[model samples]
Target chain A: MLKVENINMSYGDLQVLWDVSFEVNEGEIVVLVGANGAGKSSILKTISGLQKVSSGKIKFDNDDLTIIDPAEIIKKGVVHVPEARRLFNEMTVEENLIMGSLHGEAKEKRNETIKKCYDLFPRLKERQKQAAGTLSGGEQQMVAVARGLMSLPKLLMLDEPSLGLAPVLVQDIFDIIKGIRQQGITVLLVEQNVQTTLKFCDRAYVLENGKITLEGTGKDLLNNEHVREAYLGI
Target chain B: MDLFLQSLVSGLLIGGLYAIIGIGMTLIMGVLKIINLAHGQILMVAMYITWVLWHTWGLDPYLSIFITIPLVFVFAEGLSKYLLHPLIEKDSILPENQVLMTVGIGMVLVELARSIFTSDYRSIQTSYTDKSLYIGNISLSLPLVIAFIIAIILTVGLFYLLAKTDLGRSIRATAQDKFSATLMGISAAKITILTYGLGSALDAAAGSLLLPVYYLYPDVGPLFTVKAFVITILGGLGSTVGAIAGGLVLGIAETFGATYISSGYRDATGLVIFLIVLVFFPGGLKRFTKV
Candidate 1:
């Protein structure tokens, strides 16, 4: 559904993403894993049209994603649930979800969608009126995911969805990712949590210092000794 | 007793106009998080447009709103795109750079007005400027009363726009956090332009009211700038409702002070509130302390 080819990105003289490339097939969960400053998030940013690439082309659903604005990208049914669960702190969870439908209103089915989101995360429905800032870390992540889904996208790229969560909450988030895949939305996930990401994702890529160092099935990488040592820190 | 009732009624009438002007300050501050020191000068500029529409075309000042509002919106849009957007984009106006730049813009706009229109005060004295209606002991100038009503309508209309629309959601998103807003598919530049246009529209309405009650010059805007700055700080920078309340409070207090105290220091209410907000309610009537 999406393709990125040889994207080079830099901030002034410091290169952040060098000759990075990746792809997301329809309804597939592709995990991009790496250590800090490894350009995994940069790839997601490039795909979402938020970060400028020094050189490359990004094609999504047969459209040039690189040439468009972030709004346009989302309107094209490619929504990005950014890292840090950047829900508008002052807005209610409902409002945050409403913000997701910026391209146009899905008014006729809004109630149904809200119900679907509630079924996915009952905790969120209970606290719908609460300010997003006041939610627990896991609950806020749910709001972020729900908000991203509000766009009714064919693909959702999530950056570090399990970041800063407890072990139980992290497990719960992984389960939700599986549930999202069941709903038929393609996902490109970026994460530093190796074992969970490898277990959760089908096809995975390892990024190291702005380059793709490894690519294979989650099982292959799990059994690979070098991956275990450097990534799983075993 | 009658004089007091009269004063109170008159104070409320002008209070409404102050609310209109103060909302412009709040609207600009909300999305951009900067005081538009040039705001008052923009108001003066709009007032001149109203004057021209009245004097040149024989259109009533109130009747000219249909044109003036959109004109002001486009004018502010151009200014935001060409001037404010670039500075905001470059991240050039940090805490250290903001005051000098905003005040500098204020001065430039004022001088631009002066050079173009000269320092002479202008009055759009339509035939009805001084006509009044007396209901019981309260005598109200028809223009002043109409200005107040229109100002109220503009304020409520703007509040509705800010609170009830998709564009408003994007604006609120941008105002709260730029990065998050972008992540949510909002273009910060577009929101800023829309916000500036809305702010300028409020300023135009305020200027429309000023047409009948006040004489306008390049210098007229500075006094308004002072009042707007004070009102915005008192109300909390981003709260349109706060701006309305703060403006009315300042208006009534100043009106009473001018009558009972020294008229020389009448307008000191705004300055006094500015200092009070700085020293006391620094977070503004509520806590803008970001916590």
Candidate 2:
């Protein structure tokens, strides 16, 4: 479980996130839907300890992650898959996954986890020896997600996993996300594609201009007049 | 033809040592993405440590490697932790503050060596220094041959570290994307410190290997600094494989230039090749290996 309480974040003089709060129970897939520059990514960054929070607490299963280092945050079983699927481009697909298991218990179970990842993405298994940068967008996204899984995370945060993928590939990626939750791993996803994300996620939150504007069950938000008008473009 | 063969052989032997030096610089550049301008000075410092050990304790230059490496590793680690890492967080007018800091560090190292050891040229006298092994009419300097073998072994060891080890994975990950590496539980700060130390240790090995044939003085650092930069650029900014090729190419080019042209043009030869590589193969040997 993860709880983000009234976190305020800024970039130098520019305030990007204002009193944004959200929560995700164990094994739940929570989606944060917002327009471009609506601070969706910023919220994830703040939670992952990549961006410094001006005020607020990010607690995961009673452990304070707000002031901890990103590496330490990860060791606590919180893995963040950043936007654009920032895989180690020059490294082999296998090496990129190996990087995921660089510390703690993940290092011990690296080979096993890698096997599991390969099984999950059989296409990745075929291209294991190839450089990640040489892969197609869909394959690269698969490598990114596989890499995140390699860390044996309790909570996995993904930022726009379907950002640049084709429509068909986006569906495959979403299916993978659903599969991941079925594996009993909690997921916090930020997406610009609202309709699909709301349909799949158990709970959803609407972030508008650095603040949480709406939060409810996925079905409730999906059918809300404001949500349909603003996000679903009904 | 004999002259060509001799020059080529000699160049390759020397290139092995140069490769060791270049690899150190490349590793540093790869992780920190900053040119360690003081690289040569660090080598110089290592050479001085080797010299002192050899002169005072009768330790063989090769034997002193074990001592010099760990010492330089600690020194460089401290330098990175206390000096360089702090500057990374500070806002600067120029983006190249780190590179400029290395220049300043180089100057300080040179001055420190000069103050302590003075400007006198020094060289180690080992029995194998002048001995050579013959293969037909061509001969290989015994010390150089040994140095070359050691260099190759060290390089192979470095490759293993980068490819097979967890630390290596974290380092490569950090080089690719620092933020992402952190998310994977790699402490970028720790990796940077360790990388600086590792790079410095390699430089120490190079300095030790070169001590038998190369003369040492406070100003020796600049020449090497220039050579290491040339190799790093020629090999590709952060590619260890590229650095090795760059080192050999520069080595061969310099030797051939010295033999066919003039000894004075030996250094210029490397510079010329560096320019050619810059203009033609901007990615260095890394463009070839794609690693």
Per-candidate DockQ versus the true complex?
0.66, 0.87
| lDDT value, residue A71 of candidate 1 | 61
B102-135: candidate 2 lDDT, tens digit per residue: 9999999999999999999999998778999998
Candidate 1, superposed: residue stretches over 4 Å from native: A104-111, B1-9, B91-105, B126-128, B131-141, B287-291
**On a 0 to 1 DockQ scale, where is model 2?**
0.87
The model with the greatest DockQ is: 2
Indicate which candidate wins on TM-score. 2
Q: How does model 1 do on interface RMSD, in angstroms?
A: 1.3
lDDT of 2 at A35: 95
- Considering summed lDDT, which 10 consecutive residues are worst modelled in model 1 chain B? B91-100
Candidate 1 CAPRI classification by DockQ: medium
C-alpha RMSD over true interface residues, each candidate? 1.3, 0.9
Q: What stretches of model 2 exceed 4 Å from their correct place?
A: none
